[model samples]
Target: MKIFENCHLFHYPFEKVSAAHWQKYPNEYATHVVAVDTLDRKVLPDSQTLYTERLITCRQGVPRWILKLVDGAQECYIREVSYMDLKSRTLTLLSSNMTFCDRLRVHETVTYSPHHELNATVFRQEARIEALACMKRLANIVEQWSVDRISQKASIGKLGFENVLKQINLSVFHQLPVPSPDANS
Candidate 1:
């Protein structure tokens, strides 16, 4: 088993970052992310939190050596669940691999919140990788490879999200004018 953790600061407000996260897919930098399907979404009874569950399909090619072990599968499926709390200005995401259950598994947690002493948002990510005991000789190699791949993806993913934030005017989320009740009359 191997653990990887990283933290970064986005020079944007928490609200902006949180809103952009939903629209991050289809960005050029994250082309590996092929599809995103929302399985479920709901606002909690508290009225301050929104919960979402999604399945993400990623088109990734692994090393040839690893391919032989997993029967040449090139697509990865991930199950992601997220919680966004409006009152706390925080967004938390939990994601895990759904493919190759017998060979390996990667579970990740990511959070976005306001910085303590700055006007920016803080992004933190942690991934736990486990190579199943079945691959006694290749376990170490698999774990290390997963860590490296995840690190690279993290950088690209951040860049993609930054682009998303730039293209969308986040303030518009709150600034949209409400139509008059009698406008249709």
Candidate 2:
């Protein structure tokens, strides 16, 4: 099976919830920023900017997934992608969803600069690799539980476990060096 599929797992009508309401849940927001630095280094970094209004939040609860569109140039905070909530103890690619708030219109617009295209490519590849690593680690943990016949708790153990993985990835991603512009030019 393909690791990622493009689909709308949930239908949240905008009439029920407005963008203003969704903006409150910025803590659950995640974004991938792609850029090319001076040294021809491509940087695709994922981050949750709580202080910045650049994220889209869920109107009712925390979003399960956020879809970020990363092209060579122009990064836009598009919409919240919805996913299916399986409530499974183990994290599976099938159980995630990205839901967008009703009021926000989905548009196709690239807002980044073309000058840093190379850096953007590198960033995206690195970030994706890091995310995959985290997912693999979780899969390994789940496999261990299965082998031990341990019952996983959806609320506590699984979520907590995933959070730990995410923290580790973030820490490592932050430490990556940004290339100087002169080197690329």
Candidate 3:
């Protein structure tokens, strides 16, 4: 298994960062994400936390060598679960690949927390990739490809989120409608 981790400091408060998340989709940088469907959503009994489950469909490039070995489609599906706690002022997202799970799997976790000193938010991300193919070389190639794809997506997702954060009008956050998750481009 291959693992990756990254940390980013967003120069915005946790409240803003969390609020911006509702509208991060359909951004220019996230072209690979095709569709996102909300599978379930609920608030805990106390109403201090919100839980959500979503299915994300994304299409990305697969290396020719890997494609020759495994006949799979480029489009992939992912299951994402998110939790936001108002009392703790924390947000966590966990995602896993649903497609091609027999041969390869990627599990990622991202958390956002408030910074102690500043009104900023700290973002931490970790990803674990496993290639379960019998061939060693194929496994290596698949893991590497998955790692690279994750890295690229991480950067793109960050940029897209930053843009969303900048555009959020805190006073009228409830009025703005979130764009459709469907990516026509």
Candidate 4:
């Protein structure tokens, strides 16, 4: 198992940051993300927390050393579940790969919250990789490869969010409406 953690600061309020997060796909910074299909979305009646489940397809890079051992495409499907709490100004996301679970699995979680001291929003990400294989030696190699791939994905994901925020700022500056679905709508 491999674990990784990271933190990012966005120069925006919690509301804007949350909005950007929801609209992060279809952005230039996220070329690796091929498709995103929302399987379920709803708001809890009592607390009004938004819940969503999405299946995301992404293309990843396979190390040369590992590619020789196994022959397959680098594309993978991931299941993401998210919860947004408007009252608390917090968003939590959990994601896990749906393909090739017997060989490799990556589970990631992210949390977004308001930064009172900095007057910004903070993003925290944690990921765990499990490489299971019948061969002991192959498992070690796969584990290291998984670690590198997850790191690369995390960096790209952060940059994608930042780009979304920039676009929001630009729209506000030019008096262009930043298009986003209303929470109630």
Candidate 5:
């Protein structure tokens, strides 16, 4: 699994602009803007704007999707936005798939003071790794169960215990095996 990190500069219009103007540069004026973050705060090449009227409503509402892909072949999908607080400068994001039940959660805070410099690079790195791990585990489980079920059904000529096991393995569940007293003894 590979984690792709994207930093966006979200711009909300303080005042309304003409529909024609917006249409001309819809990507520029839309609230859900995406731009790659540089060490010097410059936008990256090939990054484009996404204008989703359904997801964004000017400056007053949260967009349905906060991140968009600018590059890469990763199929990573965002599961949920756990929390976002500007006053506290904290954000949490989680991602998971149903196959392997792999899940990743990330918590990060940003602070800026007149006397110090703030950096978000480390936090971004950590969050990307966590997300990738979750995706990888889930994908692996899904792939394995698919292969097993196909083979088992072909060989056994029936969908029974093996099929059930395959279904359980693909679900988001955890089970603990317990030992009987006699067996333990």
Candidate 6:
């Protein structure tokens, strides 16, 4: 088993950051994420929290040797669940791989909360890799590689969220406007 963790500050308030997260993916920084499908989404009975489930398909960027081990398929599916609390200004996400479960399992959890001091939003991510290989050595290698890959993905996701935030006017989220491609132009 291997573990990965990351924490970062987004220069936006919790509401803006949470909205950007919901609108994340299908953006410029997420080329690796090929497709996203919503399985379920609904506002909780209390009307303050939203629960969502989505399946995202991404292109795997592993070594050639690893690809060989994965039947040479370049894509994988991940199941994600998210809870967004409007009153508390918090968002929690949990995700795990749907494919390659027997040989490798990657589970990730993320939280977004307000940063009082910075007046921004703090993002925290943690991931664990379980590689059930016959040989201990191979399992260790795969686990390490999975951690490295997840770390890289987290960085990309941050950039993607930042880009999305830049495109929108943070004051309003209900409109769900698309960021202008020519904002700088």
RMSD of each candidate?
Answer: 5.1, 22.1, 8.7, 6.5, 25.4, 6.1
Q: After superposition, how far is residue 29 of candidate 6 from its true place, in Å?
A: 1.9
Clashes counted in candidate 5 amount to 0
lDDT of 6: 0.87
Q: Go through the candidates in order and give each one's C-alpha lDDT.
A: 0.91, 0.25, 0.87, 0.84, 0.28, 0.87
Give TM per candidate: 0.89, 0.19, 0.86, 0.86, 0.21, 0.86
Instruction: State, as a TM-score between 0 and 1, how close model 5 is to the true structure.
Output: 0.21
Clashes of 4: 0
Candidate 4 at 20: error in angstroms?
0.4
**lDDT per residue as tens, model 2, 1-185:** 01211111112222111121222221222222232122121222442211111233312211222222111222333332222112211111111112221211222111111123232110000001012233454444333332232122212323342344445446668999988989888
Reference-based lDDT, residue 88, model 6 = 84
Return the number of clashes found in candidate 6: 0
In model 1, state the lDDT of residue 178. 82
Model 1: residues >4 Å from true position, as ranges?
A: 169-185
- On TM-score, the stronger of 4 and 5 is 4
Model 6 segments more than 4 A misplaced: 170-185
Q: Which candidate is the best by lDDT?
A: 1
- Which candidate, 4 or 5, would have the higher lDDT against the true structure? 4
Winner of 4 and 6 under lDDT: 6
Model 3 off-target regions past 4 Å?
Answer: 169-185
**Model 6 reaches what TM-score against the true structure?**
0.86
Question: Clashes in model 1: which pairs?
Answer: none
> In candidate 3, what residue range of length 10 has the lowest lDDT sum?
63-72
Candidate 2 lowest-lDDT run of ten: 121-130
Model 5, 1-185: lDDT tens per residue?
Answer: 22333232112121111111122212422222222111122222444322121111122121222111112222222222223323333333332322212443322222111111422111221122233343564544434433443243223422232343334444424564657789957
lDDT of 4 at 148: 76
RMSD of 4: 6.5
